[model samples]
Target: MAGKTINPTRMELTRLKAKQKTALRGHKLLKDKRDGLMKQFMQEVRRTRQLRKRVEEGLAQANAAFTVASAVMSPEMLEQALMAPRLSTEVTVDQRNIMSIAVPVFHRAEQEAQPDLACYGFAQTSGELDDALQALNRVYSDLLELAQAEKTVQLLAQDIERTRRRVNALEYVVIPENQRNIRYITMKLEENERGNTTRLMKVKDMVLQDAHHYKS
Candidate 1:
């Protein structure tokens, strides 16, 4: 069975209004997502550069320490010393979202220094060798952070891409489709209005003619 025809003006106005509201909302959300992604991407890039530089500097210092230690301490002795008591460390991870993109929290583990491993006095080992080993350990921690950060960046980048695709689809496909439906509905409503108007005019004319004939 055919459904009752809706009033053209009211139906068209309602549909068009809804379409406009939805389109505006979608546009704002998509723009915010795009902006947030760009900002995060730039931040991560800068962090990667700085971390790489620090890690390299740490590696160089460690090489120097190992060389100096080799002169006085046998490799076996140093190894044995290193194998002694170990300091415990914990790494904490936190997660947050930036415009639907996930950000990873990275932390490094800390350790107590044993400068005497180099066969030097506590004071002697505390200076260069300790600093070097600390730096080396820090570099290792940074490498781990770098790995996590890179993985996070990759995932975020992928999300940005996926969101862009969805935004585009909404802008071009879904909105356009709704708009077309609105247009089609509007046309039908207008046609229905005109048909109603013509019918009413004819009925009025027929009633007038009948009255005129009866009065004559």
Candidate 2:
């Protein structure tokens, strides 16, 4: 059944058509935004995949080195050598906008001097331990980058889904409803107009008959 629209007049029809036009324009804009976001989301996804692979490889290398070092060195000696740290790290978080979405950016403040990866005495610690530490340090920046990319991808995916749902609602629900209302109003108005025209014609015929009878 067609949905009923109250006061099916020309004015109402005009209003409904205007609303439909606006809805179509808005739907188009939202679709464009969704597409743009998808493109950016895919870019971030690819970057995250590559960074994750690199991070995993670096960690594996470091773990292998640690395993070799453990086999040769005494646990007590390793513990004593790595028990204390000499470097301090400061992490700061900030945000940047991407397509109206704010994403986190993490930074480790630059140090006055580059810290030595070697925390243990060379005389006592195995060279394998040093290699392991170096490997881990090498991937520190990559790890942060991977985190940023993954987070950006997550946010973009959420926004894309939201935009898509809204677009669908306008395309399928709001616009269609307005169109139905407009059609109903137009039909009602035309029907009323035809009825009025027929009534006027009947009145005109009766008046002419009365005049003819008076003349007779």
Candidate 3:
């Protein structure tokens, strides 16, 4: 007796072929998404680096301005000067979606300074007060932007990680299983075809022998 026989039905081969085709298409689509995600991640990394550099520069400037403003000006006058530069900050934050990730977008927070002559009433030059105020305000703005950029980059990094895992699963697990199943079904069908051919030949030979005996 045959150890085991596969069914010779055409349905098995047809189904296997269909599965293979579907797997191939899915594999290609996943690979494309992985590539696109990587590109977006790289771009965000570059922006993060540039923003960090800018923030450091702004901090240095603010520190220098504060030191000089304190040494050359009186506490009352300097306090007045600082208060004059007080800003009314209004932030309009929105989110930008890239590869299904929402990144923060800050529309240059609206800033307004209270103009008071009493704040500028000091022995220090107008240029010096103006310079210090500008430096301090720029530093504050830079810090805010850096925070947003850093947060955006961190979120994008996570997305890249998640996408990579999915890419690996499809490439290594799903498609390979489909291919293996298809191969097994194809071999089973071929084996069944050979066995059926052999049975047909044997039946024909037996019929011929019976006819010869009758003729005799």
Candidate 4:
């Protein structure tokens, strides 16, 4: 399989050597990138786990508070109180590169000034409803952070897979093939040189014999 399509010459050998060197260098760089990405991915996974737990607990508390409030207050009154929301928020998305992977960053962009959770009058709403709203509000930042961390993990995983494939191709396929081709070309050139030297020696001996015969 070696040098089947390759020219067995010194020029071809030199070219293959240069190509092998480049492949090896690229393989090393990609391996480093993969390692760095794995490190960042693991850190992001840990952070996402923590944020998810916090968000879940906060949501559970809020749900319990809402249940209590619903039981104590009339349905009509509760519905009326929550009909109009006083706060408006927007989310701003940005990206940062980690090991050449672009990952999302989320920011809680408020359309209006930050306002209290109490959208309704205290006299009209139960304390339980206030607690529920406060609990939900507290988890918003963590929810955003969790989203960001999870997205980062996803992006890192994809880039790592891509880099791994390239490394494998160079290590298992490209480098070895080039090395075989180089050896084939070198052997062929050496054989040709030996053949030429043998022929030159034969010619020299024949010339000495002919000159001696002419002298006799």
lDDT of 4 by residue, 1-216 (tens): 483688888888889899999999999998998898888889988988999999999999999999999999999999988887777889999988886677888999765433665777888789999999889889888899988988888888888899899999998999888888888888888999999999998888789879786432
Clashing pairs in 1: none
Off by over 4 Å in 1: 1-16, 60-81, 100-102, 109-132, 214-216
Q: Local distance difference test, per candidate?
A: 0.70, 0.87, 0.71, 0.87
Give lDDT: candidate 3, residue 188.
67
Clashing residue pairs, backbone N/CA/C < 3 A, model 2: none
Q: RMSD in angstroms, all models?
A: 5.5, 2.3, 5.0, 2.5
In the range 52-83, model 1's lDDT, one tens digit per residue, is 78777878888887777666666665665456
Scored by lDDT, model 1 comes in at 0.70
On lDDT, who's better, 1 or 3?
Answer: 3
What are the runs in model 4 whose C-alpha is more than 4 Å off?
Answer: 1-3, 111-115, 214-216
Residue 214 local lDDT, model 1: 46
Inter-residue clash pairs, candidate 4 = none
Query: Candidate 2 — which residues are off by over 4 angstroms?
Result: 110-115, 214-216
* TM-score, cand. 4 vs. native: 0.91
Looking at model 2, report the run of 10 residues with the lowest lDDT sum: 109-118
Error of 1 at 1 (Å): 22
The digit string of per-residue lDDT tens for model 2 on 143-165 reads: 99898898999999999999999
Q: List clashing residue pairs in candidate 3.
A: none
Would you give me the overall lDDT of model 3? 0.71
